[model samples]
Target: MHSILPLLGATSLAGASVLQQALINPTNQVLFGSYDSKPLVSSEALEAQITEKNLRKRAEDLFSIAQEGVEEYNHPTRLTLCHTGHLATINYIYATIAELDDYYEISNQTFDAVVGNVFEYRLVLGDRQPDSVLAMSLTPPTPDKEAVFGPLVLVANDGCNESDFPATIKGAIALIKRGVCGFGDKSALAGKAGAIAAVVYNNENGSVSGTLGTPSKYHVASFGISNEDAQPLIKKLEAGDVIPSSAYMDAIVQKTGTTNIMAQTKGGDQENCVMLGGHSDSVAEGPGINDDGTGSLTLLEVATHLADYKVNNCVRFAWWAGEEEGLLGSDYYVSQLSKEENLKIRLFMDYDMMASPNYAYQVYNATDAANPVGSEELRNLYTNYYEAHGQNWTYIPFDGRSDYDAFIKNGIPGGGIATGAEGVKSENEVAMFGGKAGEWYDHCYHQLCDDLDNLAYDAWVMNTKLVAHSVATYAVSFKGFPKRTDVKMNDVSEPSIYHGPKLIM
Candidate 1:
């Protein structure tokens, strides 16, 4: 219900005039009926509105927002849930939608979220601080005057078990290998064995970084180091060298308030709405232009263009927050909805990382019987659009990896698409998508280099158009769409399958 008056002046008079006409007078009531009357928004027309130029403009805007935070916060990264960059991101999306208030009802849904912040972190071995040290998420912040100092004891196995820590681990910093268990388990086990802190080294190439899952009474401060950085330390330790190490960490995890921006078309069926969303916040590593900036902007661009015509079913867009920390915003939104409100939503679509440099047109495969009934229909909508356009696509699981988790768990049919993230491309995928087979789909998935240059413009545009086509199609009719069923809430005790920084195990 909140509106920003300044945004009204930002709209073009011609576009506003056309919007007025489209909403007040139309020909086809069966296909499209507005609050008043207007022409039905066609798939071709909506798709035509999605352009590379528009996408890049918004991408650049988002990148600058994150960059501004880097300069303001004087930190390596400040775009996550605990940073000012995220606040700015929320404001940006809100303003964009507020500008088109005439066509949509915009609101800010605020909620309390558990967010973490890292002020200072370091791990020094024998007077040398390695560049590969990364502070694990949810690690308890260090006191201002305290820094851990002791022998770096190499734990047996992955340090997932209490017995993995040797007798000498008392008052030491345990060095464990990353695998076999969650980081939280390793750190907790190390603490239980009398270690002050724990450091996990990567099992594979590249630097390791992840959450300890959540704050726990048993967990101690934890850090992740790269494989290369740990090899020499391990060799020296095995040679009976007491490698003196010092660790300093200053961070905190606490409850804070954040907002979810939502916009629904004023013209479509309010009783049977089509919803779509993407997380607006990035990780602490980088600006995350492709990680979700692509998804957020895609929603923005489509919503902007969608204002020009009427629809049969209401279309709603959401810019979710704190997805990297976990699915906080989306989950909060879903939790607040009444049973009637939940049933009002016909289906929900999610878009995340739409433009990986080494991309693939991967649609969410909602074929699992566990998925909500009609979830497959939502999947087919995107596949049909791709197939009609001669675009090659593959299937990815609806494993509750994104914001769709909340909706699907509530028995609302959910589906969407993503390019790829962190997953290595196969030779067959290279044959279809034409990228380096062994390399990550996005080398800069969660790194300092995930800037504007990281996006694949071609892939982004294709996916954006696909989004437009789907939105237009759903908005026009639900002829073949299934009716909402009384589905019981999914088991709450099951572990999360989201690909957020948290370890799945």
Candidate 2:
């Protein structure tokens, strides 16, 4: 039998055959292969090899590493790594989020309630808020204008048509129920009816503010109220009560900032690197635990464990900022890189939300028409992993909706997996994933309720394992994949910009 001294560092016959069997197995080939002279290494030799540590072990260790990251912020209860210069998420870039742009006060924004007039009113400012609140008296515009408001007129139904406005609505505020038509249409219709201002109460339970599509002469300052507050007023109005309320709005916009965290291995081959990351910031409402805490921590843990092993390629980890502000951080980083620098990256994998309470195993559908080449293999990596382990999985379209958007846009191959977000669970998904049907995969999405309790540990661990698997797999080899230098950057479109409220960090 082959000597066990070199493999195990001590000759012990008890496990020699098992070690010998492992050595002969080609599948167990280690990365460095310093101990692989005789075709394959023994189990003892392979165990001694860096590759034998396994992805699951590394993934499990992420819990503590993530905890360390969270604790670094001095928040023992929850980790909100927003707007910090934390190294855990920092990469090659050293600037903060606001520094990404120099013109027009890039990240500055400020808004406070308009003093006495601010009686819990939710105003819809479509993508533009004034730098300072300029109080304007509420009044109905003239006939040549869109709407009139003075004697408030209650629309007969959801304000979709001109007929909903009666003759009595002239020079009066139009009180309309929300339904049937878009908010802009209702506001414009009310404006046409000679209403001074449009008050659209939500059909649902929350306050609403939205766009009016495009600017029109008829457009008036529109507002929204929650159903709870509107119901009592609706009753009084039907009983012939005239409710007169006036409020002033003062909006302040300032240029402020946050940051993205990036960390890369100093040991691996810098010429060929693999990158992965998720957003580091959270919405202002609450600490985003499952949204990306899972993703960020996964990378940190992988990076931590990887420190002990040697690899053929470099691994860079990033925690993006302003992702909720429209993937601005990642976009800026990629834009700053030269064509030569961009080509240094072989691939990027984005991990956003990976632990929805009602989780569904979702692999990116790289086969979709929009995908760049080599995405199919990335998708196959995730799908194949889940399937091999007898786990159910599904596909989410590669719609340029995450941090991966910038990487793919510049022609780097990319793929990833997410448990899910605000998407509602289907009855079929309920059957497959064993969670409540008709509920959101993340019920607390973007809300203050998204705390540590929001995570499903089983799902979190599973997805992190997959992340480790991807990292280890790619770190070991890239034989079948195209090199970054060989592929020209595609003229890809930017990810669909979300003009809605910022819901991520």
Candidate 3:
């Protein structure tokens, strides 16, 4: 095992910085300066110390964080970091000796919240005997309790202009094809006309589903249908068939509170911070133990352990909220940063769902052409580590599927690790990882069953050690990463836009 005792007395630290000097000097030592001359200094030793028992204890500590909310709210709701949810997680983080604790918000956000939609629709074709048909899909925030019944009018692609909705659209249900602009814009334009509800069929095949970007003044009850299902109606409308349909929406739109817990080290180079995070909130379905609790606690445990170790670069740890609601907290955090602060973040690492019971070691495909510079190196870090341990690994795209979405949107180099979420295991994955094939990575994903028992301790310990490895490596040096001086200043001027495929739990 690698030992750290000899490094403490090395004379090479004579000219080092404050933290380096403290770490290297034997006389001016703090907690870890000299621990019985047999400290667990090496990465392997540290990893060894993070036993399953320790993880259970730390997880229990995290449960206490949620327990506080349960006591007050009479039920644990670590659902989102918004409102009281944010306060509880923040309190827990502050209980640690973090240097920075703050909530971040996007400048000039119009709605306090564009709450997620909860609506249902029933389709009825217009004829002497109209038949009841079901919509293949429905978008949220549909007009709750209100129903819109009328003949369907087709609006072609890029349904943003009023002209797209023909004069017949007045008091009718607008049938718009999805393309060009967002689903919200099409619905808004239809609402601008006299259309009571808007239904956007998919531009391609299969079921249609997407957010309206956000709530709008002109937004009406909106839902989606498959191209195949909508073609008959489109053809009938083309043949002048007055197909009448009824659309209704029931949704709750209100401002809910949440917070992002950002903790920066006070003793490191503030100009070149190494940032890492995982979403702090859970889905409303369950406690979200493996979904993100494992990911969040990985960083939290690492942060607590590093309290005594000095670092060259400021390491910022964030426990984001509203991730399940969309990448809300991370997007807001990126939005509020100044240009200088944005540039200071040399790299961002995201961790979510680190312990899927039926797991596959998947690293983000940072080597993809779309990723910012230095991403490939991040990929290599994890790949090399796993390979060194004789473990097989796979790659997932660096798409905007997680909290890393916001960072990458602004051209910040980002990478992360995940044990799968709803994805089913393949035979190859089964052979490599020894998990059952054709089963979800996490059987209880986003379900009420995602409790403490859902975790796979073996996977959790291994993945969390990887988190520690990355933190320790970057804390000591940015060897495999681009330095602050070499960073390309990408314009992150675009205001925060949280739009994309839903990040399934």
Candidate 4:
């Protein structure tokens, strides 16, 4: 068993002594026997163990960790890759798993990854300055430490086409709406039109953040602003006002190291393992309580309850880092694995954004040809569970947006659930799940307001129960489950255009 001493190093001697007493109990000691000693856990029993109180406590803890980062950095943070809050989050998960040292093997997988670090970003329009502006990735910052200043020019449509920029737009800054194309495309179009810089504003209520997919010579310094902040400037430009604007962004894309936390049951069949995970890091916008905190904590909570019983197949839980920066951590882990190691993983399940304010029980639709052979079975597991519970469910496509991208591409079956993000709730969805129509499923998705108040408790608990049910079912048997065949690496081509939620390109 790994030592928990490191976690208690900062505690008072008396508190340390008490914890030591609690850990030394005979039941907590590792047994040197075979796997037959403990009885197998059932889905119903495991699901019963999940509670709203425990889930909320962990959510509160994550929220507090984000707040601590805010205090330490004196600004908002999303537990960005290898940052203070992110490291703290890794420590918290490690410590929690260390407490159950007798039942699981815990380790940290560290690897190199590229992440964008923003030092300073500012957007000025006339006398008004927006409080939040997200710097688009893979684009160069302003040159010579100078802001790109010019007269604001509103694009014809979404700035996806060359025709959107008039010939008179030279030396001006193009103001584009969020929909209809990739941020990179918009910036490239604006730059080709001789615009100095580009600003993409959200069409919805909250702030927006995205990437340019890859480096492009035609791309200019670009940033994303909120609807509230961009509406006034948009109206002014439409009303024939020559609004003066300036955009300055100081950021860098560099290679850095981060850790992925993994814990697996010691007694289950090691050759055929069931793996599940969620990204631990968040964007730089807010605490990311809902963006991924809910997913990470759900895995943690389920792992805690799982420690009490045995399983037929080894169950591994991962809290991945650098997911926000394009599935960096999970991709790196997959890349390092040998074919034998990859085959040992019978299936990989991912849970992200389990709780959205205007929640919909959406499961990953694994019927896409790109998905592995066994993906359909994995999808059925989740859908069947929801049906048995008399719950209304929908299907979401495998858009290669989350951690599951790596597993699916490697021909390993992958599927899971998410409430929603940035996507508007349809009236049909509203009738199924009670929330306002046309509003975002997670109004606070990747925003400053995604704190504890952002979570939907009822939905969180329901999805967490489903998580436990899946774990319990898969751990006991893969009786009818499809066998994983030798993996034929798929065409790992990058998407033509990359943007968040809705695709304009």
Candidate 4 lDDT tens digits, 373-481: 7788888888898899889999987777788877877778888999999889999998888899999999998778888899999999999999988899889999988
lDDT of 3 by residue, 334-440 (tens): 87777778888888999998888898999998763666677778889999999998899999866677898888767788899999887789999999999899999
Compose the digit string of candidate 1's lDDT tens values, residues 1-505.
Answer: 2343332222122112222322211232222223455568888878876778778778877776776566545533435453467776776776676666478888787788887766678888777887898888778755452798899999998887777889999899999998878888888888888888888999998778778766777667788989999999999999999988888888878877777888988777899898999998887778888989999989988887787678889999998888887788898898888888888888899999999999999998886366777788888888888899888999986776789888888878889999999889999999988999999999998887899789999999999989988899889998988888564533222455344645533
Query: Residue 313, candidate 3: how far off, in angstroms?
Result: 2.3
The alpha-carbon deviation from the true structure for residue 126 of candidate 2, after best TM-score superposition, in angstroms, is 20
Task: Arrange candidates by lDDT, descending.
Answer: 1, 4, 3, 2
Q: Name the top lDDT candidate.
A: 1
Show how many residue pairs clash in every candidate, following the order shown: 1, 31, 11, 2
Evaluate residue 326 in candidate 4 and report its C-alpha lDDT on the 0 to 100 scale: 72
Measured by TM-score, the strongest candidate is: 1
List the candidate 3 regions with Cα displacement exceeding 4 Å. Answer: 1-42, 58-76, 81-86, 97-114, 117-144, 158-160, 204-206, 227-240, 485-505
lDDT of 2 by residue, 173-282 (tens): 67788776766677778777776667777677555544343335675556666677667667877899876644232322123444445555545577887788787655
Give residue 12's error in model 3 in angstroms: 49
